[model samples]
Every structure is written in structure tokens, then in C-alpha cells.
Target: MAGITGIGSGIDIDSIVKASVAAERAPKDAQLARLTTKTTTQITSLGSFKSALSEFQTAADGLNDASLFGTRKASSSDATRLTASAEKTALTGTYRVEVEQLASASKIASGSLTGDSNLAFASGGKLTIGLGADSFDVDVAAGATLKEVRDAINTQLNEKGISANIISDPANGTSQLVLSSNKTGAGNDLTLAASGADLQGLVTNRPAALSEAQNAKFKIDGLSLESATNAVSGAIEGVTFTLVKAEEGVSTTLTVGENTTAVKDSLKKFVDAYNKLITTTNSLTSFTKVGESGEPLTGALLGDSTVRNVLNGLRSELSNTAAGQGGDPFRALADLGITTQKDGKLAIDDTKLTAALEDNFDAVGSFITGDNGLMNRLSDRVDGYVKSGGVLEQRISGLQKTDADIKEQKADLETRVAAIQARLYSQYNAMDSLIGQLTRTSDSLGSALSNLPGVVRERS
Candidate 1:
């Protein structure tokens, strides 16, 4: 309700009512606003911290695999003639490779027919095509054209490594049906059999093979080898040779060696990622003086025990030695040229690292990614903070709950402040009405006395 303003009592009742309500509400509003700001800041800070920790965990996990150290690179002296690839199981060695003859696929063609490619057959029957252990049948309809037979065979037998096409000879007015195999190996020849007289002409009196099926002949270290396909594997352990062309007399070298470059790159990546994570944590927990005689500004995660604990855990793991060592030289990260700096970040010595990888590569793998190794321990520690229901997650959950409660309190404060304002308006309006009534009563008495011949009205 609107209160009377300076009426009858000559006082600003609305202003007085406003002042009273404000005085009643000022403290509570300030308290809730401060709580809201503080809670929101904490939530944002924790979120950033969690993101940094998760990123660091990913870096650690990348280096935690033993296979990364066992990776091998295979190379051939003559890349155009032959190329090779190696797996982790490949042994490091040098071998001479000689590709003798490349494998070939088989193709067959029927005797020439005395008509155009569109000539219709007298009758049709079941035509079965076979390649290796796979075969498919095509039912040729009576009076079917040569083009129709080729289309039907292709539609059903393309995936089975068999394809059919019509080779037309326009000069002689004759056409021949040709069948080919996609497989390149011995005993994988294309075969055609028919059951009807019209289809028998395609199989019974066909010419010799257009190209004979043959196996790949190659030699590794002067040991003769044969493969059904051009891609030869298992001749050399963990090495696959893709024979490009036949180089019968020419010899090439295939060298299998440790992929030390990959390992070095991964290590460098881990170092960079670790440093980036350290920078993030430092920023989140920093404090600085703003100006002369001004208040100092603190970071959102300053003095956070969770951050302290996480850093401490990782640092402790980095400083620990790997397990089960009997005077092994490369037993820790320090031995592999990784060291801690004054600012608590990792530093890599390139020369020392390369030497260590060259000298004892397997030992380097054992120290960094073996059982109870530094990366494994560090990754485990990070898991405690970023995993579901972990420490950081629980902390964030609690802060969210507190924020929700603060919101409820803010809502309640608004309700109470409104009730106070309404009551003050009602009370002040009633007081103004009473004052007006009292002034009217006094004026009536004074007029009666002045008219009774003894009292006179005075003017000031």
C-alpha cells in the first residue's frame, strides 16, 4: 500500500517507512550476496583444476604401455621392387631378399560364336563358376542374349572373385565370353561348367587359359620360399613383404631395427604435457600483490588441500626408484635424462636421453613403463583425483550443495524483507490518519471558544 506523504502531520511518512525497511534488510542481503559470490568462485576454480588433472592423466597413460618401446621399423633397399613392414614381435636383423616371380591370376575364354555380342543363345541352363574353394551358380534363361548371360554372372559371382564379360570381334562378326579370377595364387584357377547344350559351348570347347594362375617365388637370405599370394608373410618372423615386381637376379636388403625415434617423440610429448599441467596448477594456486597499500589478490585454488595433495603425490612418485633392480644403470627417470627443475617441473636432456635409448633400450622401457614404474604410479595417483567419486569430484559435489542451500536462503530473505515493508507501510499510514483527526478536533474547540465572547483567535 502507498503511504500518505506529508499530509496532516507535515512529515514524509513514505520516506520514513522506506528507511525503516531498508535498515531491516541491509545486513541479510549483504550476507547472502557474499555467500553467493564465494560459492560460485569456488565451483569455477575446482572445475578448472579437475580439467588440468585429467589432461595430465592422459599424458601419463600414453607412456604407460610397454609395446611403445618394442616398436620396430622395417625398410627395404629397393622400395620400388619390394617393401616390408614389421610388428613389435620382429627381431632386429638384416636379411637379403630376392623376388623371383610375381603371382598371377587365371583367365579363360570361350570359342568364338558366329554372331554379334547381342546374339541370343538357342537355350540356357545352370552355369556354375568356381574359384579356389568358392563357387556360385547362375541360371541362364532360354533365348537369353550374350550380354544378359554376362550381366547375370557378374551380379551373382562378382564377390566370389569371378567376373564375366563379352569380347566382341566386329571384324569377323564373332564374340567370345571371357571369365577372369581376381585371386592371384596357385590352385585358384577360374573354372566354368554348364548343364545345357547352349551353355556347354562356353565350357566344353573353350581355349586354353589366357593367363595361368601361379604362386609367388621369392628368397630370404638364400632360403627359397613360395607363397600363394604376392604378399608373403611368415617367411621371416614378424615381417610382411609386399612383392611389387619380379627381380630374379637383383638382390635387396631388408633391415629390421628398433624404432627409437618414436620412443623419443613420445617421451618429448610426455615432458611437454607434464610442463603444461604444472603451469596450470601454478596459475590456479598463485597469489599476488595488486599495488602499494592495496589488498593482495589470491587465486581461486589458493590454499586448497586437494591441489597440494595431488602435487605432492605425483612428485613423490617421480622421485621413487623402480622395483627389482640388481645394479641396473637405467633404473629411474633420472637415469634416462629426465630430471626435476627448481620450479618443480620436468626437464629433458636430449643428448643423455638419446644415449640411454641407444645403449639399453629395453632397460629404458622397464624403468618408465614396467611394473611399479613411475608412469604407472603417477597415473594411479591422478586417477584418485579425476575418476568418478574421487576426491575432486566429492569436493565439487559438496560445494554445489552449499551453493544450492545459499540460494534457498536468499529466496527466504526476499520473502521476509517484503513482509517487513508491507507492515511498515500499513503502520505509518494509520499514524498519519490519527494525526489528521487530532488536528481537526483542536481547530473545532478553538473556534467555539473564540465565538463565546471571552476567547479571541491569535495570528502569528
Candidate 2:
């Protein structure tokens, strides 16, 4: 079998050096495998930690997971802490309220007014006509400036929630400032008056022209209490509302909840990570070498007890219960569908793993995430190894140092070996060249002797 081939025509110093390099890296690969396994284990352990944290939040452990997700509810100013239980919260309350409907007097109160236009201008007395937008009392005095009327209208509109403006005939310069109510209904009644007397014509319009109604409703605790417009004070808390209709009321009940999604997600994420680590670790042993090369799995960590011990510790820690607790995180690897065989190798039981997770999530959560949580310990281990002076870091540092030293030693040796090979090649080439020159010289001498037969006979 062609195990390996080289580009060089023959064995040389370069080939020897290449072989040495390959040998050195074989051991380095072993070290790399161990690190990879450790990293995978540490990562899985941390994942288990977070899952436990999620379970803690789900129970009445009282740390609302909603706050962790950024939707913690605002505390109301009047919020009272109630001794509410899950059982008690589900029960609804029955409410009762009473109200008075026919409270308004049977008769409509009435008033009237007349303006300066009805009598004469230049009269000193002014009629004060109040408008609805405000308590704007218009001064309808004879020869009184229009500006005064406008000011009164504006003031009344601002104060009384009424509107007043002049509707003037542009052609005649006669303007009647009108009044209207800001609200609906006859409650916004119109009134008229005169201050300097003789302007009593402003009140000349009698009460005969108007009719009005009084409206009322009742509500209790935000629900329609009933149609009570007026009530003796103090029924429910400090709130006594004027109910316009028995038909309309606000919702009296509210529902409060917490979102455990983040906590759930955090837990789920940890499970996935743990599973992935197991898968990856198992792959290290699973890979079959059925190819022509048939190289054995020869990583430095292939048979290291360190890797086995780490795995054992992780499983042991998880199987341990929290302090003062009755049960272990897991009853057995089999509970999680993980098992150890005759050869002491780990095996996965997917069905068992699923069952364990489904039954008793809190137990599983605590098992993985609690103070004595598996994840915390795993993260601690991973963090230690990954840090600047941790195991992985230290290992890598050592490898680099070894590589540097090896390179230096190899370089010095290569120089010496190259010099020897060069000398050997030079001596061989010189010997071959010398042999060729001598053969040519002999051939020339023999040819010269043949050509000169008489001289050749004398020499013979």
C-alpha cells in the first residue's frame, strides 16, 4: 500500500525533517482532542444551570419572572397589598348600589330679557345680556361702545364655558352679539339684566318662552350604581359620582399576570446546549474509520481519565439533591435516558430524557439551576478553563512554547544536516566528473597512437 509519498527524488534532509514534524503534531492533536472535550462538557453544564433558574421563577418562589423580561407592572399610588392566593383570586365579588331617578323639580325655572334695539339708543342705562359660553353680560346701553360689549362676551365665554360673538350686518353696522351654551341641555339657561335702571326693557321678555328638564343617573364602584343625580355623601370610599344614565358604567375588575417567557426561553436554551454538548462528545467516539487509510482515533484525550472524571463529576453533581432536599436532580442517567454500559461508556436514551423533562419540571429545574445547580458548576469550570490562565489557555500556551522550542532545535539540526548532504553530493559529482575526463583523455591517446603507426611501433 502507498502509505505516503514524497515529492523529493530520493531520501534527503528535507524529507527527514518533514517526518519529524508529522510525529510531533501527532501528540499535539491528542492534546487538542482533550481540550475540545472539556470545552464541550463545561458548556453543557452551564446550560443546565440556566434551566434551573427558569424553574425557580415559575413556582411561587415569588421572584416574578416578568421583571426579568422588562414588563414589571408599575405600582399604583393607591395600591394595597392583599393577601391573595391563587385559589382566592379566581372568586368574583357580588356588588350592590342604589340611586334616585326623579330628583328634578316638576317646573322649569324661567327668565327673560329685551335689548336696546327694542327701545332707543343714547339711553344711559345698559341691558346686561348674559351668554352661555361664559357669564358674559353684554352692556346694551344707548351709545355704549361696541368694544365694551365684545370684552364682556369674551370674558363670559372664558369663565362660563359659553360662546358669544357679534353677528353684525355689514351694510347697516347693527351687530347682535349672540350667546350659546358650551354643553348640551337646558341647564345652561339664559339670563338678562340692567344696571343703571330704566334699561329694564332687557328683562321684558318673560318666562313664558322656555321649558327644561333635569337629568340624573347613578353608579357604584365604577358600575352603574343607578340613576341618582343627588345623594347624601359618603357611600363608597371618597368617590360619589353623579350618574347621568343607569346604562353606562366602567369595568370594575382587572386581571394581573406575569410573563414567564424569558425564564422559559432561558431554560429551553440551556437544555438545547446541554444536548448539543452530549452529541458532540459522543461524536468523538462514534466516528468510524472505514476508509482505505484506516487511521485510528489518536487524539491526546482519547483515553484520558481527566475527560472521564469530568463527565462523572457532572453526572454526580446533577444526581445530587439541593441541601435539605429529598430528591436528587435526576434519579439516574436512565431517568434522562442516559446510561453507562459494561465498558463504562455513556449511552443516551432519548425517551427517558423526554420523560424526565415532562414530569416534574421544577425538580428538573432545581436539579439543573439551583445554588447547588449543575449549570453554575459547569459554567464555573468552563469559565476557568477559557480564562487567560485557565486549563485550555495553559495547554495552548504550553503547546506554543513547545512548538517554538522544537522549531529552534529543528532549525539548528537542519543547518548541520544540510551541510553534510551538500558536501556528500559535491564529492560524488566531482568523482564522476574526474572519471569522465580521464576516460576521454585515454580515448584521445589511443586514437593518436593508431594514426601514427610507425611512432606507435617504436613505443610498442
TM-score of 2: 0.40
Go through the candidates in order and give each one's C-alpha lDDT: 0.85, 0.43
Q: Report the C-alpha lDDT of model 2 over 23-118, residue by residue, as the tens digit.
A: 645565566556556555444443343333233223312222223333212111111211111121222222233333423411211122223223
Best-matching candidate per lDDT: 1
Pick out the ten consecutive residues of candidate 2 with the lowest summed lDDT.
Answer: 75-84
Best by TM-score: 1
Per-candidate RMSD, Å: 3.7, 14.9
- What's the lDDT for candidate 2? 0.43
